[model samples]
Target: MSNDHGDEPHELRVSKIRSGTVIDHVRGGQALNVLAILGIDGSEGEEVSIGMNVPSDRLARKDIVKVEGRELSQDEVDVLSLIAPDATINIVRDYEVVEKHRVERPDIVEGVLSCPNRNCITTGDEPVTSGFEVLEEAVRCSYCGTIVREEIASLIDTA
Candidate 1:
C-alpha cells in the first residue's frame, strides 16, 4: 500500500515454483552446497531459482533455493539438514505450498553422507565408510572423529 505522504508501495519479490520444493532460510553461502548435495543438476533440467543474502526477519541474512517440477525425497531433506539445519522446506504445487517442514538432523547418520573432514576415511577415494552415534544430542563424526555438539548445532543465530 502506498502512503499518502507520497511514499511508494514496497515491492515484494514473489515467484511461483510450478512444482517441487522451496527451501528457505538456508544459511548464506550454503545454497550451492545444498543444491550439489541434492543432485539437482544431475536430474533433467529443472528451473532452479536461487536467492542469496536475502534479508530475513528471523535471520539477518538468509538464502533460498527453489526447484521446479521436482519433489525432494526424504534422503535429500536429510542431506539438507547437514548443511542447512535451519532450513524450511516447502512443498509447492500449482503455486501453493502444499506442505511445510523444518529440517531436522537425524540421530544416527549412516551411509547418507561423507564426513565433512577432508582427512576422514569417508573422504578418501578407497571406499571406507563413516558412521556416527548421537551421544547426548551431538553427532560424532565417527572416522576422523569429531563432535558437532548440540550447542554448535543449536547456534543458528544469523545475527
Candidate 2:
C-alpha cells in the first residue's frame, strides 16, 4: 500500500530457475553469506541470482538466492541455517517447484564452523573436527566451552 504521498510500490520480478535451488526468505541481508556457504562466488560458471532487502510480509524484508542448474547439498543447507534460520529452500525442476522446505539448524554442527577458542583441540593439530552445540542465540564449542555470539559469517569454514 502507498502512503499519503501517493507513491506506488514497485514490484520485483526475478527469473525462475529451470533446474536448481531457490532459497527464499533469507533473513533480509544474509544472501551473500548463503552464497559463500555454497562456495559460489559467481566465478564457478553458474548462473547465480541474488535479491537483497526485498519486501516481505513475514519478515518486513528478506533476501532471495537462486542458483541455476545445481541443487544444494546437505552440508550447504546446514551452513545456511546458521546464517538464515528462517530461510526456505525451494527445489525447482523444469521451471516447477518440486520440493520446498525451511532450513533447520542441526543439533550438532561439525566442521562447518571453526571454534572461537584457539586452545581448543580442533584448532591444534590434534586431528579433531570442529564441533559445536547449536543454541538459541549462539553456538558453543563442544570441546572448550567457548561461545560464539557474533560474526558467525566470518567463522564459517567454507573449505
Candidate 3:
C-alpha cells in the first residue's frame, strides 16, 4: 500500500540564524556534545537551535547546530573536529551563508584540551596548558603520552 509523497520537496526543518555559524553534518547523536564543545549551557542566553538525529543523505542520520550571533574560533573548531570531522562550518550574515568550509583535523592541538592523566604536569597547579598530538584514532598527550580515543567529547576541557 503506497500513499506516495516521497518525491515532494521539503521545507527547512530548522530555523535559520540571522548571523553566526551553522555546524552541519555532525554525526548522529552528537549534537548535545557539540553544544558542550561550544560552551553553551543556556546560562548566557545564547540563541541556539539543534537538530539531532535528523535524516540525512550523507550520514543516513546527522545532527546540526545553529548558533546565532556567535562564530567559532579556530581553537573551538579544532576541538570540534575531534568529534565532528565531517561537519561543515557555515558563517551566516543577514540570513545568508557568507562562508562555508569543512573542519580540518589539525596535526597538533595546543592549549585547548586538558590532559586526562592526573599526574601530568599540565594538570598540576602550574601555569601550563595542555597539548596533544592528533593520531589516526586517538590523541596522545604531549606531556604524559597518555592516549585518549573513546568518548572524546567527555574529555573536553572548557576551562
- Candidate with top lDDT is 3
User: Residue 131 of model 1: what lDDT?
Assistant: 74
How big is the positional error of residue 125 in model 2, measured in Å on the Cα after superposition? 1.8
Clash number by candidate, in order = 0, 0, 0
| Two-way lDDT contest, 2 vs 3, winner | 3
Over 4 Å off, model 3: 1-6
lDDT of 1: 0.72
Whole-model Cα lDDT per candidate? 0.72, 0.86, 0.91
Task: For candidate 3, write residues 40-148 as lDDT tens digits.
Answer: 9999999999998898888999999999999899999998999999999999999999999999999989987888889999999999978999998899999899999
Error of 2 at 91 (Å): 0.3
TM-score of each: 0.71, 0.89, 0.94
- CA shift of 133, model 3, Å: 0.6
Per-residue CA lDDT of model 1 for 60-95, tens digit only, reads: 899999988888888667656877889999999888
Tell me which residue pairs clash in candidate 1.
none
| Pick by lDDT: 1 or 2, better one | 2
lDDT of prediction 3? 0.91
